[model samples]
Target: MTETLSIGERVAWYRRRRGVPQEVLAGLVGRTADWLSKVENGRIELDRLSVIKSLADALDVQLGDLLAEPSLLDWTPDTLGGTVPKLREALMDYQQMSPLLASDSTSRPPDLEILRTEVGSTWSAYQDARYARATRLTPGILAVAQHAVRAYEGEQQREAQALLAMAYQGAAMVLTKIGEADLAWMAADRGLAAAQESGNLVVTGSLFRSVAHCLLANGRPTAARDLVVASVGYLENDLADASPTYLSIYGTLFLVGAMAAARIEDRAMVNQFLAEAEQTAQRLGHDANHMWTAFGPTNVAIHRISTAMELGDVQIAVDQGPRVDTSTLPLERRVRHTLELARAYSAQNRTDEALALVLDAEELAPEQVRHHFISRHLVTVWVRQRHGKPSHLLVGVAQRLRVIG
Candidate 1:
């Protein structure tokens, strides 16, 4: 007979499968490894539904899969749906509390558990909306995240500050994906500031990496490189600790280095950075599954494709591009992979393939203005190579995009 696993045992099993040690998993989940061990052994119980769900997500399993009885498929709708609206209202109130707290300490404060409960509910709702691509929910979620940061700052709570910074970073990443570069940059900056004020070097370094990514996506390669270089000293010191945050920052710096080298047409530098990135990733393993480093393997592979194309290594690009599983990635990242493949195909004089890939990307993100910019850049390089006649399709798309004069 198969062993019956309690929720805690399921969590432990999944954590081990993910290659995360108990201590490391505990850090990511904001608890002690001893506590997690007791919970896994069924000697302790946790009442926070949100924490349980978060743990499930980190383990790449559904909440139902992690439960002992596993019979609550329909039960969540009643338990969660009825509470969402009130939770949303409470989250908003918490957001508003930041500004109030900044100005007036005499005001009575809600319990910490209350804030966590509401934030957890709001986060679950946001995740559902995110997967559905509900654009309307983004702004509201972002507002709440901003408020959380401000409130944490007002209260001078280190853990709260780190969590709030993460919330802002997640919002900014979504905004960036949806073609709001300016707003994303603003949010990233705010998160960085909060991280610095909290005196968490790990959070600060990670936020800098996010800022560099926004700069890179906006076509500011030089600025991005400078930001990455500035992060090197901090990352070097932090990496010795075996912290997941350090691994994330170190990997991100390598990615930034690869991109910068590609921009300047330095093949050797690109290869060096990619190699370093791979080494760091191997050392870190899946055990370091902090949200800060979620981009690891996928990010490294994407940059490798881009770098290979820039260096005219067509075979390398072709071989590596198809190995990536774009379906596991977000839509924004999938669009980027398509754009890179288009460029790589064009480099090999595969004009038809190039055009097909670009068309697919355009269709996927029709309303996203930045995709057009990327398309124009790829088309310009392909045109320069004299791979094909400048057809009406190219001219029409470019004109509609207004990216090319």
Candidate 2:
């Protein structure tokens, strides 16, 4: 329903739904009530995606919900240029390989232990923001895992199934970034099935999170929230005596739930989920990436900043972002947190700072930043809004990224 509206129409709709008076909303975000009124009435065009992003955050919706076009497919990597990369090709192969799917041998397969280590290495690449590298490993892992699942019995079979689930989950993550929601959903669907067979709570929760992530990218926040909410039951029985591994999984599911709530502007629900996640994080005491979940006190704080951004409190995002140290976290998390802060700065019309942060992201991870929609949006805004000569760096990035002529 909300997806059909124009950006301003969506803003007015969300703002009213949230029951924030124009004066109140404006004042909360450091803008004049008249400015907001004009924005809502179409007296002014909200040309900057960054500003619109801030407005949506203020309205407590996902940045896409207020977008002129909310479909992620509009700016998918394939749409950015003509061809999908090798990473996407690997994912395609995961679903396309024929012989691998048909092989049903019940004999001892390849080394399960060696396959498990390789799976861990792929996951490490994902954490480092080496998405292309990570995705490139997925197809091979998926093939190996399928063979292991058919041949190995007992504990080795269970381990193989777990690895297979993670491989699918990994495919889903990278596929989502490339804006292949349908493909990503397919991978997630396979992952959930494997998790059920493995009967591993942590793997089940993680796979559920992967599905939620795909749904979120596909603009089904309500469905995503419901999906994640149902998966929380996996952690309940063991949480009381949970190890750090269980705690991380426990907290991450809730955090992802909070994000889903944020997308729909359900402040109370978001807070409720975050509060539960906070308790779990507190028990864990410090930040650590267990099962690749990255759940703990610092991680929870990072999500708080993200929630604040989703809630449209740019000031809170700005304030909280710097306090969380990125050095200890994975590069993917750092890139995500930093990009949000860059959006917050752009919301305030701080173009130079936003540009600088955009550059920082590119420097931190070339793969993630290359052909990124946010970078393209930022470049377009800088071209439209900058006086005289823009920064050589900005022009260079925009030109190199083909964001501007």
Model 2: CA > 4 A from native: 1-108, 371-373
Give lDDT for model 2: 0.74
Residue pairs whose backbone atoms clash in candidate 2: 57-311, 57-312, 58-312
Using lDDT as the measure, which candidate wins?
2
* Model 1 lDDT tens row, 228-294: 7678766686566666667876787788777766765667777888998888877776423354354
Candidate 1 regions off by >4 Å? 1-139, 142-156, 174-181, 217-219, 286-289, 325-331, 358-372, 376-405
Model 1 residue 272 CA deviation (Å) reads: 2.8
Reference-based lDDT, residue 308, model 2: 82
Question: Number of clashes in model 1?
Answer: 0
**TM-scores for all predictions:** 0.57, 0.78
Please give, for residues 59-147, the per-residue lDDT of candidate 2 as tens digits.
Answer: 77765556533222223342333223543565466443344655445545779789888888878877776665665677778888877
Q: Could you say which candidate leads in TM-score? A: 2
Error of 2 at 237 (Å): 1.9
